[model samples]
Target: MSVGTIVAVCVGNGGVPKHPVAEAKVGPDGLEGDRHRYHLHGGRDRALCLLSVDEVRSLEADGVRVAGPGAFGENLLIDGLDFSALRAGDRLLVRADDTPIELELFDVREPCATLRRIDRRFPDLMLGRSGFMARVLGEGTLRAELAIERP
Candidate 1:
């Protein structure tokens, strides 16, 4: 049981610099308050995006300053888990209420053109640190301080 903490819950209408919310409703498609501008960005396989705080720290160590929670277009900011240990198709269960919200980890998210706003080399610099895309398997309320596990 690789348990991690939800550092933040973020949402965006269409782009980067997503705003962090105290809590949000997770649905089969994605988080209730979120939406994507591009079609390729959203769907069952890529319903939500996740970012590892460890990765953010790595970037910060390299002098990269993340604007905030949604700067990377991630819906969730997680901490205390080795992202490399998780593989595609792996399921993440977030503890909440009576049931755990399930999320299917997809492949690493491809750095998009929007990231250029941060730095031209951001795409390349964040190669392995960009984090993974995910599909919601079980819907539930998401908020900070929640426990998420790779089970």
Candidate 2:
């Protein structure tokens, strides 16, 4: 069982650019209990970016740093989790209290020079060497304690 921690949480809309600054979402737009939502690639959709806790360390070590979820334009900054291992069409069980948001891994986020511009250390960040991305299969409350069931 791979364990991880949420270093930070962020949310934003489709207006700001160049590190839009993360925010916390309140009310029930599907998110639970004051959960913040981050907008990625414009307001085309929700569920922005994700990162592994281990990835956080990788970035920190490199000098390039990010807060968590939307910190560096990523919606989710997970710790000690491997995003690559979860492929497209894979169902991820996001558990929190009695609420569990089922997330489906959609695609492999490829690396780009832009990431390097944001943080020179990004190019080497966990999948940063390969780039990172994620698609939410379902929207709901996702607490710190949760696990993904391999489908």
Candidate 3:
């Protein structure tokens, strides 16, 4: 079985030092409501960000917060699993607490120069195909301890 983990989640318009707090929400056309959604390969108007679980683990160990560069806002940062395996329409069975919540992999979340700007090491970290985007099948608080184990 492929194992995955939830790195972190942020809600707000362009998660910066000061911004109105909000929850990560998904809607049609891949718009994250008032948030921006992007693709891992090359797409626009979607609120998605992808990073390997290994990278997330490293960040957590260092006690660092993965914030967007100035204005770009991302919701969830995941780690550990092979992102390329997740294709559009693939359903991710994420275990949320006692309940098994589902998120549909809707698109490929490619990287951008802004990502490099946010984390100077991002260019090295997300060297290959790093992450992708998905739509929430169920609404809930995507906490840090939560796991994205593939079933």
Candidate 4:
């Protein structure tokens, strides 16, 4: 099983660059209070957005300056698990409070125009390294620094 930890939990009202949070309630439609600017974003099959820590560092190395977690519009920034190599239907079990949140990878998260706000090259740079879009198979509360298992 692939193991990792959720280094950052992020949420936003309605746009790119989500802000980190201490904890968040995750449901079928993703983090409560998190808003997607477009309908193409949030749905049963595309509820949550996930990014890898290394991907952020890689972007930085390539000259794409990132503000922080959620800068790519990701809802969860995991430190070890890289979903890019995982296929659709792969699952990640987030060890939350009392219940674990199970998420299924479904698709690559598409970048929106808002990403240009970070940098003109930011949007294109995020192409394959952007992250994955996942749906909550099991819901629960998630906080920063929690363990995540890809099983």
Candidate 5:
């Protein structure tokens, strides 16, 4: 079964240096108050970005200094899911108080030059591991440690 737990939730106003937040509202337009470069990020199909904690650990082990959560520009940092197993059209359900927030994975995120600025090796280290993008199918409050399951 595909399952994971949100280790962290991050957001940024419009650029790099996305910081972690305790909770946030996720909607069709994406996380509340979150913004993107527009030219290469943030659209319906690319509403939310996710990266696995495992991926971060791997990068750290490789000596790439990722600042912290949101370092890769992911809105959600999850643990225990094999990101490689996910493909376009895969659905993820995040258990919330009233109802689950559903997300549809659609594409792999490409590392941008901003990453290189963080660490000259970041771009290459995240070549195929940057993360994946998704669209919000259902809106709900998202928090860290929420259980994520594939249905």
Candidate 6:
């Protein structure tokens, strides 16, 4: 019953405020053009960040104004997956265009001050809803509307 699809792909050259992109190259380091301000943000174990559309919607319903996908610095926005149910050691297989990419969840992404700066209540509102940090298991190009497999 592994079923999910990528709804958006986002990347930023430096830090927070990542914007949606049509596609991106994912490597062992991370999204090709993306950069991290602190060492905590990027590395083999935290190469990519993922967030669920349902989580964002839930936040919005709670009166938190989310600017939309990428606002939380997520590299991939997926739909139909219960992000909360996923834990460390879980793996995700993505079929991006003709390329296949694999990622393993390492830990939950903690909300940062930057996220709180975006909205005063963001920190508390996004406490456990931030998303997950993952390491790249395979390199490939990722794009929106791609299918995602969880096993």
Ranking by lDDT: 1, 5, 6, 4, 3, 2
Candidate 2 at residue 105, lDDT? 51
Q: Please write out the lDDT profile of model 4 over residues 1-151, one tens digit for every residue.
A: 8899998889998787799998888899889879987888888898888889998898888888778888888898989885656887888898887888889999877777788888887578778788889999887888888999887
lDDT of 6 by residue, 13-87 (tens): 656678898888888898988888888988999999999998888888887777877888889999988787799
Better of 1 and 2 by lDDT: 1
N/CA/C clash count, model 4: 0
Pairwise TM-score winner, candidates 3 and 6: 6
lDDT of 3 by residue, 60-126 (tens): 4554455432122445556666665667777776667666666767666554565555566654554
Which segments of model 4 are wrong by more than 4 Å? none
| lDDT at 35, model 3 | 39
Alpha-carbon RMSD, candidate 4: 1.2
Span of 10 residues, lowest total lDDT, candidate 2: 14-23
> What is candidate 5's lDDT per residue for 28-138, written digit by digit as tens?
989998998765689899999999998898888888787889887889999998888988899999998879999999898887777777788767778878889999998
Best model per lDDT: 1
Winner on lDDT between 5 and 6 is: 5
Better of 5 and 6 by TM-score: 5
User: By TM-score, highest first, what's the ranking?
Assistant: 1, 5, 4, 6, 2, 3
Better of 2 and 6 by TM-score: 6
Question: What are the RMSD figures for all models against the true structure?
Answer: 0.9, 5.5, 5.7, 1.2, 1.1, 1.2
| Model 4 TM | 0.94
- Enumerate residue pairs that collide in model 6: none
TM-score of 5: 0.95
Which one wins on TM-score? Answer: 1
- Position 11, candidate 3: lDDT: 50
Off by over 4 Å in 5: none
